[model samples]
Target: MTRPPARPMRADAVRNYERILTAARAAFAEQGSQAPLDDIAQRAGVGNATLYRHFPTRQALLEAVHRDHIEALCRQAKELLAAPSPSEALMSWLKAVVAQGSTARGLAASLMAAIGTQEESWCRDAVFASASALLARAQQAGAVRPDVTVRQLLKLVNAIALATETEPDRDEQVGRLLDLLLDGLRATSTS
Candidate 1:
């Protein structure tokens, strides 16, 4: 019997796998899901076979890219938790979230699809929990209205990201729009 085609990757394969993931993340962020897998392999300085061995399909690549961004977004939320004020923290996080959502074409769509689905529900929950904590802080401080929910903020950011999808200065526009939204969230004084 022919020796089984070189039993899956050996110990060193793990390092190459990680490097491919890192390179793919950067390439996908810059070129979207359509970015050539060959380019990713080249950037990782790995052979095409290695890239294929790790990620078998285009969907796998796309999902990995999505997962990476979500992980980064969650990390950002943790950092924002240390902000000086609730309102400032919430606003800054929202802006960063929007920018993150806008990094690649169709990313916002994929995130929305995954938000409540069983596929990535745990990740979604973690993200929501982070946002909820910030939102509650803002609300309790009277910096944000009591009625706003994390889901609503997510919808708003998704909408804003979608609206500015093709704009040249999309992030700036998203920031201005978010400022308007946050302004409306402030408690109005009834003098």
Candidate 2:
């Protein structure tokens, strides 16, 4: 039998949800995934019961935060698809991914590490599909080499992310590293 339609959330519930998510994102960014639930509730200006009602477990909250980031990246990739330059589009999305991977603490790393587990991470698949689409477009345009796979590109960017994780000047450092990576990714002119 088909399930019944889910009702839309009330205004107060929506506000609470947004508040908790905002607070949790900040807490996770600052203190990693292990940030205390009570503190998150306090930051959100909600009681512990409200926080628990919204997110039953620490893992649940962590997943929401991680999934939101991944979803945003996927959305960026989708938007970049319409860009006139395929190479530029791919590079733009890659920069965002690198920024995400290089996020201050282990929040991104921990969530990324959990993909494809028992949960059947649609998040991972969405990311791969978006990356492949952008990469394929650039490859077809002859802007990037044909031999480069999505996995290789992602691994390279993630390495750059990890390398700059603790750098005080992460933005500048990521930019320099990305330029080097761009050099390697470009299609060489055959005279």
Candidate 3:
């Protein structure tokens, strides 16, 4: 059996496609889903027609942005895994996740929308696996309580991100909040 021929885009079209995705990512980070496609096209130095050719709908563009951020977050998790200690690695990864969550307004909602689509869930799974591995290591070393789950940690980080908005010392606040969570995750003498 013969496979069907692959559709090939022109060199200029491929360049425009990449530019649109880059501009879309920046715009979504800055302004969320409400970011205008015309503005993205202008930023990419492509016409509206080119942007529409690459992404016909705002949902598609938003999904692309969401997927890109998720991938980057997963990559950060891999980097954190290389740190010396389980506690240090988990804390560092939590900080990175919190920072990403804080900056990406509407990200949680976008991610929910993208979850059940045909898009691969590699990024999401990678992040969870990374967190799980770190948490397991910490638990095994008696640095963290065994009861804590990655899901719980994620929820707490997201809550912190939502709560400290508009504070001039947001990063400091997040650090304090994360420290508190970490303390709670520590194994207790009575347990």
On lDDT, the candidate that comes out on top is 2
Error of 2 at 27 (Å): 4.9
Score candidate 3 by TM-score against the native: 0.67
Query: Which ranges of candidate 2 are over 4 A from the true structure?
Result: 1-27, 33-61, 101-107, 110-119
Q: What are the per-residue Cα lDDT tens digits for candidate 2 across 87-174?
A: 9999999999888776545534544454424555555577779999999999999999999998788778767776787789989999
Order of the predicted models by TM-score, top scorer first: 2, 3, 1
Runs in model 1 lying further than 4 Å from the true structure? 1-63, 116-120
For candidate 3, the 10 contiguous residues with the lowest summed lDDT are: 1-10
lDDT of 2: 0.79
lDDT order of candidates, top first: 2, 1, 3
1-191, model 1: which lDDT tens digit per residue?
Answer: 11112447676786787787778778867776568999999999999998888777655555555676677778887887788898899888877777877766656655565554565454567678878888888888888888887888777777787688778988689878988888887876667
Residue-wise lDDT of candidate 3 within 157-178, one digit each (tens)?
Answer: 6577656744789889988998
TM-score of 2: 0.67
Tell me the TM-score of each prediction against the true structure. 0.66, 0.67, 0.67
